[model samples]
Target: MGALLNQTCYLCSNTKNSIVFVENGIDIVRCSNCGHVFSTYEQEEHYEGYWDDDSSYDLGWWDHAHREIYQDFIKRFLTAPSGKILDVGCGLGFLLSEFKIKNPVGKPRVTKYPKKRFNLPGIKTD
Candidate 1:
């Protein structure tokens, strides 16, 4: 069997050595070179769980009222008639979906390259 490659520190970008810091069933790797810290190999998958946690207010919490407020904010400063908007840190396309709902005729787009669950109706993953 091939040897398991250890994950390097995301901050320092070092691969020589690492120190593990385990907390709440998660392992964080700290690099000796720059003293940078990051999670282990399954870091991405691990943090994804935090995003969907019940205690956390993520995409599911965005209701019609929140959409109305967001729309109002957009209309107040933005002059364009909602044409081809891109949400940078789009969590689960809820905001994009809300925007589309508010302006049915307007063009709505989203980027979900990292997260597969966020790819849904009215959202573009590119």
Candidate 2:
């Protein structure tokens, strides 16, 4: 096992942690207090792996693939009128786009730093 990070757990802020596994060079650790599993790999501000030289990033395939599940989740849990929604690690914002279509007036606010810009129209990232 690689060296376990001395960082505190993001969920419970506990200093005690155990190495779960390592994937592709990143250490996946589990918090002793909250049992929340996360990677210790620090990501760059602007990740370019999703946006390569080809047009794969602009294919819009993820939207179609995840449409049914996103719709179901929206219908089931998002019935409440006064509630805040936060989509973390929201790659390509497909779920957010679906939510906007379902709730035209309500806008999903972005909390995490955008790894890539949203190509989908109508959904505002601000």
Tell me, by lDDT, which candidate is best.
2
Q: Per-residue lDDT of 1-126 in model 2, one digit per residue for the tens?
A: 764544467546677778899887667888889897877765443454444435444446767788999889988888787544656463655676665432222113332212234444443332
Clashes of each: 0, 0
Each model's lDDT? 0.47, 0.58
Q: Let me know the TM-score candidate 2 reaches against the reference structure.
A: 0.44
**lDDT score for residue 58 of model 1:** 40
Candidate 2 — worst ten consecutive residues by lDDT sum? Answer: 104-113
Best by TM-score: 2
Q: Model 2, 25: alpha-carbon shift in Å?
A: 8.3
lDDT of 1 at 68: 77
Reference-based lDDT, residue 103, model 2: 22
lDDT of 1 by residue, 1-119 (tens): 22224566543456754546565655566677877676554424544544433444544455544777767766775657755554545354445553543322211222332223433
Clashing pairs in 1: none
